[model samples]
Target: MKPPKGIRILLVDDEPHILQFLELGLSSEGFEIKTAPDGASAVEIAPLFKPHVIILDVMMPEMDGFEAIARLKENLSYGAGIIMLTAKDEVENRVRGLTLGADDYMIKPFSFDELLARIQARLRNQFPDLLGEVVHGPFRLDDRRKEITHQDKVLELSPTEYELLKFMVMNHGIVLSKTLILDRVWGYDFGGEENIVEVYVRSLRDKLGDKEHRLIRTLRGVGYRVDLP
Candidate 1:
């Protein structure tokens, strides 16, 4: 499904091909995109663009991603999710980028689908209300109609199932306890067994074709969490 309209993204990379590739891909998905060849250009454009998300390359000619992030974080009055792209897979670089306020990181040779997922995840985390719809990986929830879709196809769901799925998707990255899930999805006064959550979760997994349990993860003693991207 397409994202909410007027979502702006800034792509900063030293390579022309990389910038062109991402600009084309993300623009097709209904995002307003701006491209910069290096960190200096990114820093200059970001304040005016006020991008909701910035895809920054770690290695550049004058100022790298780390320095850019520092400048952007200090200069911008609002929040923007910054994702670092680097060929290096070293833990030290990852830590440094994150330390300098990069919201996420990706290595080179990444699949477009994975990058899209990461971008969506960042939106969900940092700009949930701006999304106008709840999106987690391939799943999209239309709260206006109380409908959910996977991979752009609408899923047939019972009312309770829809509510449960909405709750899960709205809080995808967090571990939601069964009690909390029941309280939110079903009324606290409903007095149903906690295992009912298990039953519904199984049903959701089946309908979503999550036979491998990749979408909704069971924490054994804890509750479930939707782990995408």
Candidate 2:
């Protein structure tokens, strides 16, 4: 589904390629995007743009991500979810960013799909009134009600079924491994067999009227992806 109207995003990175790539991809996803090459520029532009989310690169010339985040947090009147991008995957860097009020962090060379998901997650958390319901093709998930509807028809689902479907739909178009699904849908401590995922998938497919396996595609060696236009 298209993003909510006027959902602005600020992209701050030194690399032109990264900024261009993110601007193109995020613009296609229906986000109003602006780019800043350095932290000072980001700080200067953010007050004017008032973006709902900011994707910041850790390494920059005049002001680094940590300093940028601190300054942005102090300057912005409204809360903007900040996601830090860094090449270094050290624990100290992650801790520092979070301590400085960054909402999330990502490593360099990340999946575009994953980054998109993280952005959406931030929006959902920060602006629930705007994104309380998630729509993907025919399906709509009412996050507040913990309910799902397809084509305006509400489906009766068990608690676990609802959680599983929510996870799949929220991460639509991305292949999810059975291990990941199990851990997310079921708990990591769940001692159930891996085949439990298959059982739930079959149940979900049946409920979704996916007799031909068109909605949820199964990759034999990989995992499952919810295919929607």
Q: Give the winner by lDDT.
A: 2
Identify the runs in model 1 with alpha carbons over 4 angstroms from their true place: 135-229
TM-score for each candidate, following the candidate numbering: 0.65, 0.66
lDDT of each: 0.85, 0.88
lDDT (Cα, tens digit) per residue for candidate 2, span 37-108: 999999999999999999999889989988999999998867899999987556788778978899777888
Error of 2 at 192 (Å): 22
Error of 1 at 223 (Å): 14
* Model 1 local distance difference test score: 0.85
